[model samples]
Target: MTARAFPCALGAVLLTLALAGPGRAQTAGPSPTPDHMPKPGMSAPEMADRAAGRFPQPVRVGDLPGRFLLQPEESQPVLGRVTGLVRRDDGGADAIVRLDGVLGLTRLGLQPLAWSGVGARLVAVPVEAVALLGEYVALMGMTPERLRALPTFAPGSATAIPPGETLRIGIVRPFH
Candidate 1:
């Protein structure tokens, strides 16, 4: 087609689409399945709530290990690395995170005591308290002080895993 005719044809198509309105334009495709359809009489928020309930992407315990634990709000977001997953008698799990002592010391505004290596310690963080964002496990609403206050997690000890509890996955260290 000629350049002048091309512009005129594009303008006519655009005008047709503009007159169709959003709802009319979107309704051209096949109807959504019942499971995908929004329930009648539901408000926007209600529909959202219903939709959220249908799909729950649970983070598996096996997948927790070796992933970086992030506290995004803090200046140093990379708080630690997940060492393992501890399973409780109640069927719940805790993420064993070996926190970076240097970051902790800096967060608390204290200098490191030793120059050789920062004294990294393990802490058990409830899996429920964390959300998996891509490759990172994000722990929200937890401060450095709060994290420090948590009792250290000692693996292979009676106190670490009560009689019935077990360590489903243990320290996943990267080979140098």
Candidate 2:
């Protein structure tokens, strides 16, 4: 076709699409398999209510190894302040803690399987194995002195300590 005719056809096509948008009612997508999706506002089955006495035993805390301390790298909210800290409470090996929730870093916390030698394997870090980067905490350095100092469990332990003054933060397993 000539250039004039081409332009006219293009304009027609554009007008058709514009008009179709208002005239058509978009259909819903195919329903997913019953087991594959839940109805709106529904909740998935939770672990059985141990307190309800459905079984003999209550949900044991130790059964949930996931409840143990999480490294800053393990949690993604992008910001964590030390919530509760106590050195030598769980013995001389580690500190007990309750890490304050991080900000804007929750999605990052979901990457537990991506943290290792293959697919993010589990890597346990000592309570002292981290530092605060303004709002971002990181595993940067660790020394006995630094551990007992910043990112430490002393008086000000839970207070989102700052990054290294001199110590090079490094990971530490429970044992030496």
RMSD of each: 12.6, 18.5
Highest TM-score model number: 1
- Write the residue-wise lDDT of candidate 2 on 1-176 in tens digits: 99889999999999999887875365689744332111232221221121112212222222222233323332332222333222243431122332322222333565323221222211223433443333233433232223223332344433322222122222222211
Query: Candidate 2: minimum summed lDDT over ten consecutive residues — where?
Result: 43-52
Q: Rate the local accuracy (lDDT) of all candidates.
A: 0.57, 0.31
For every model shown, what is its TM-score relative to the native structure? Answer: 0.47, 0.21
As a whole number from 0 to 100, the lDDT of residue 136 in candidate 2 is: 32
How much is the lDDT of residue 171 in candidate 1?
A: 18
lDDT of 1 by residue, 50-154 (tens): 434433364455555788876544243687888877765565566788776754674465654444237667888755445555677665424445665678788
Q: What is the lDDT of residue 124 in candidate 1?
A: 82
The prediction achieving the highest lDDT against the true structure is 1
